[model samples]
Target chain A: MSKKLVEAMADLEEDAVLAEVKALKAQNVPALDIIAYLQEGMSIVGKRFEEKEYFLSELIMSAEIFNEASQLLGGGMGGAGSSKYGTFVMGTIYDDIHDIGKNIVTTVMSSNGFNVIDLGVDVPTAKYVEAIKQYKPKVIGISCLLTTAFDNIKECIQTLEKEGLRKDIKILIGGGPVDEATCKYVGADHVCKNAQETVEYSKKYMGV
Target chain B: MKTNKELYNERLTRIKKAIALEKPDKTPFAPMMDSFCARHMGYTLAQFCFDVELSNKIMIDSIKDLGEVDAASGTSSFAGGMGLIFMCRVKLPGRELPENALWQLDEQELMKPEDYDTIISKGWQAFSNEYVATRMNVDFELLGKTGAFAPIADQRMREAGYPVYGGGVVSLPVDYLSGGRTMAKFMMDIKRMPEKVTEVMDIIMKNNIETMKAGLKAAVDPIDVFIAMARGCPDFYSTKIWEKFVWRYLKEVTETCIEEGIAADFHIDANWERGLDYFKDFPKGTCVFETDGMTDIYKVKEKLGDIMCIKGDVQAGKLTLGTPEEVYNYSTRLIRDMGPGFILAGGCSIPPNAKVENVRAMVAAAAGK
Candidate 1:
């Protein structure tokens, strides 16, 4: 039954995954055990993505199924426990409200076992400072779709430096317009081309 | 000295020849710029968004300043029409944001799942009218004002010796639904209720094609219709899902454009290399593939150079962050390598903060300086 659940999740068979989750729960499987299976399935999904067999749509569908199946397990994935990897803090920078990229990264990060702190869109620099102080994430991501927000990202990173929070955490940036030039301009440690890159970067940073 | 009328004709000829996959006298520079014009002209983004006449003047003047440009992708823009195009509410600069901030789309789940049935029953036009008025909070007056100014802007560009490329804008139903329902939810709908979504899309496509044909018929000297397809990039979907949801409608729209005797300017954003081969089905010289720098343009040339005219792809990052020499070198390389059927343009639109010298370098490269 567990193998069926994992395979269903990997194949993005939403109904089958839900049915199996319910069956497993009826069989008195622990919520943690069920979440482990889902994660394993997501691992397959991610590997497919890296191999180009899947794409962003598949990642999104797999995440949605995992979330739905987690809901069926009584407590949500949030209640599963702390991630083995450390927390990740992220948001779209100030004056940029685009959230699709940011949301994708956070969702992929959460499914990949990082506790993500999504500060939401149009996030002020102070918010990043606050998130860093509280979450103490090993890596942070700043997303910006607008060229106008580049200066704001620069300012956000400068604020982190001023607040003495810049030394510990690696700052990564990504979005439509961002590139290595943007990474340099914004003083970020790296630029992720997509969500999977974010997961890989954070995982490497966390040494997981 | 040549008159502006003579110059306009020459430029138009150059652009048309490039689209027809013929070698022109020189490569045409047809950069798409909007907010960049506002900043170049020292106007606030708020002013550019709200004042159509000023926006038109800014774009024309900016193009003129970039010497030897053959055409412009678009001449005027209105922030209000953004909501209609994207099917979401827009947060305009100076209204919900700072006086000079760039306008943004405030995407939310404004169109519920049941709205698909509404579209099926009421039709896209009737349903969209009610949805925009009730849910989108679009300023109809502003839309009207911009609508009134677009012709004037096109005329002004012609008078300034530049041919405007895009006749009108059309979008896929998938893009509309994605914007209205938000991407995540819409992607979910494609999984959970694929049939219902396709039904709604078919209804919307019928109306959209009719509207596009009507707009093209009414257009004065229509050339190519801009078909926005960023949201439907194959990078975001599996081969099966993309073929069914995105390519079907996209092909239909492009076929409609071909049937109507107008070029389809595909304003494709994001990376579309995975689906580049799909464009091979189109007849030679009937389409223009305008990519936004994400897709490797060289591969586009390698695959579709004989089939379609290629425009674009000086990246936004390079324009905003790199120096004039880099821009000049890149543009010169493109002109040298990708010409005959090539039109030089910024990847999508020039970023607002792109250096004036860099833009000048791009034009100069095309001018063979």
Candidate 2:
């Protein structure tokens, strides 16, 4: 049983993990059984990405494997055995079009089961407001690859303040040219250290 | 009587001799390529970065703009559009631009080898396999050009007062961090995982080699020009990083260009200071190192000597804000200092929105008027 747990968590193979998770049902596995199994794997991958034990390439690979496993779990769930979730809206601000980092975060979030809306690049403050009004999401994720567009994040915050929505939505930022200082200076509530941290933080913040 | 090419070449030689701190025909004067000058001549920066017809026109016009200078030149991107993401609107004064974060599906993960093939083969090779070059004759010219490029997103740095157009891969943590992120990670990796970082840099070098290899073979005139192929300006990269990561690899690429009989220049946009020793073993030829801002061109003249020509050092910010006469005076001073082993140019990429007439006057000053 210990070996099975280790095998389940240590396996970075997408289909193999999914197969193992699926075959557990044939053996009359409990919901707690699969949840506990997948959660271990998530933790491992997340830690690797965070501790610098993994590269973006490997982190991405692990996420993909986890996604495959997630499909098996999401589909096989009985009505009472449902997972709780959170939503994140991500994008680059107006006049700045850089998305590699944010896109990675969005993928991890969606695969990890957060409802994520990607407002494509060159987004202005108004669009972010409109999205928040529509989604009423608790978290707003912003990514910028250019220093010039740094203001967009602050601009969005200012806009939210004007709309009296600043107190409600938490802002999260990450990207090549931005950092924790930028996150604070730009007035974000939180900033993920990297992809895995993005998932872990999103889960914790999302109450998932 | 000395022939015109001989006369031109001799005049250049004299400037070269003077730059060597030897006697020569007074000082060498040369003007760099400029857009605002072209715009003042009625061409736009957008038109300059793109349309080569206009770009070539501007290049030729620069000769007339700046008089009897030694080596005349400037930067224009005739073929650069890969990796950068820009969406074009075919409207009045149409603007094509990079899309924001929403358009990316990068996932900070492995693209699988198959995706790599798809991306690498995006241009002519794929286009040929998919669509016959039907536009070869009249049909081709009718279809306006579409090019792929590493996306050039714009920016305004914290220190920079205004939003400036700048782009060249940044914000890639996993890409960078898979090695070691913080100083701690780097030190730890150096002690424990020497092979890991070396392997990563090796991969980077290989990619750079292949990329530049294709560029070397891409027989086009403007491309015969290698821009920013200047890494390791000392300001952005440390001497350690420069020695370890940049130097050898650039040497190899530059060697390949030299072997190919192509003209290449290293465009350094930062103040490199007295690190001339770093570029010593770089591929030798008529290799030119282009700099912007307060790069001591005279010192560079002494250090590199005639080994490699220095290209530019006109401070763009100062030039843009200063008077035409001030521009002329500076141009003259630089000409005297730089002599023949250099080309007069903007210290960096000329801002898209710079004064035109000032640029023209600076050019005239370089022509020995």
Candidate 3:
């Protein structure tokens, strides 16, 4: 039954996942066990996404289904599923309103049992520094889709360094304009092409 | 060491030879003129886009400053059709959004799943009119104005002896539906019902073929139309998905043009390395594969250079931000690597914000200046 639940999540069948979670709860399966099954499904989704078999839409849909299942299971057990993969703070930097990529990274991160705080688009550098102080996340990701925002990304890294927050957390940058050159220019530790790669890097960072 | 006319013909010959996959003395340069005209005259994009006559005048006048080139400038008529743009919910720079912001199309599913049956049966034009009425909520006046600008630019460019390639504005069904269904929803639809998607694609292709035939009849001989495949790259979907949904329709469109003896030049946007294997299928000497610099043009040359003509590799980022020397170096590198069939151009439209000197540098480098 747990394996079937994983399959449902992997298939991105939101309704099927909800029904399976409900059945498992009714049958007295441990909430932790259900959460484990969902994570396994997420791993499969990640693999498919990395392999180019699945795309951004499928990755997002799978995350939504997992969210629904987690909520259903949590409601029955009187608590939410706990994330052991640590925390992440991510956002699209200032002057750039694009967020589809950032949102996908957030979903993938959260689905992989990482607590993600999505700061949203057009985020100021100061807000990032503040979020870092407040959340103390293990990872900080900044996204910029526009060529104009390249300088702002560099400014963000400089701000982090000035605040002495650069040493504590790993910084990641991603977007259409961001390549290896931009990554190096902005002084980011890593450049992620997509959400799947971001999740993989986060897993390795968290050493899980 | 040539007069403007002599230089112009020299460049045209180089471009023509390259398109035919024959070796030329030098690589030809055809810069993708997007917003460069307005900026050249120190006018806002809003001014350039809305005033067709003014934009045309600026393009004609600016060619002297823009230097010797095979063709003049052009962009999608977003300005000429502001009413339709707003009605269609398409975003624009300095108008519906910010002054300096780039114009963009909002990828919302303006059409729903049930609309598929209507499109399949009602046909493309009827459904297009319906879409304008329902989705755009406006009459065809603005859209007509937008289209009207194309001829003025085309006529003026030809009269000036710098013939513009009418990037044949036909979208494959999947590409067309991508706008209506939005990319994400359409992708989902493809996954959910491949058969239904294929059915609609057949309708779209038939409509597109008719459009192509009409265009061929309207234009003079040496009929080359730039196929706007900007959103048709393999990056958005898997290779298999691209084959199933995009390639079949694209092949049909290409075949229709080839059978009619028209040159089908393709303006393919985005990185299409994953699907470069499919380019081998296109009939040789009949098409020019114009790229937006995201794909490795050199890699493509190594893979499919012998099969079809290829042009591009200058990036918008480099043009907008990089120095003139960088532009010169990149242009020279493209010429050195893929010279014979190469037409020097941006991998995509030269962004409106491109520096004048940089634009000049690209043209100069192409001319071996």
Best by TM-score: 1
DockQ of each: 0.76, 0.04, 0.33
lDDT of 1 at B233: 91
Sequence-dependent TM-score of model 2: 0.48
lDDT of 2 by residue, A116-139 (tens): 677877788889989999878788
Best-to-worst order by DockQ is 1, 3, 2
TM-score of chain A of each: 0.90, 0.63, 0.81
Ranking by TM-score: 1, 3, 2
**lDDT, candidate 2, B1-369, per-residue tens:** 644446545654544453333545554444344444455456654555456455545544544444454543332333222111111111101124332111121212222223223434453234222322331111222123322221111111111111111111111112232211322233223333445555554554455445555644542222234444322444323355445544655566566556755444666644566467766765444466766654667767777755776666666544545568777788788777765555566665443334555666665765677
Least well predicted 10-residue stretch by lDDT in candidate 1 chain B: B71-80
1 versus 3: better DockQ goes to: 1
Which has the greatest DockQ? 1
Q: Model 3 segments beyond 4 Å from truth? A: A12-18, A25-36, A51-81, A93-113, A118-134, A151-167, A184-189, A194-197, A204-208, B1-12, B73-88, B137-142, B220-223
The regions of model 2 sitting more than 4 angstroms off are A1-11, A25-36, A72-88, A95-97, A106-127, A130-139, A146-155, A168-208, B1-51, B55-255, B258-369
Cα misplacement distance, residue A178 of candidate 2 (Å) = 5.5
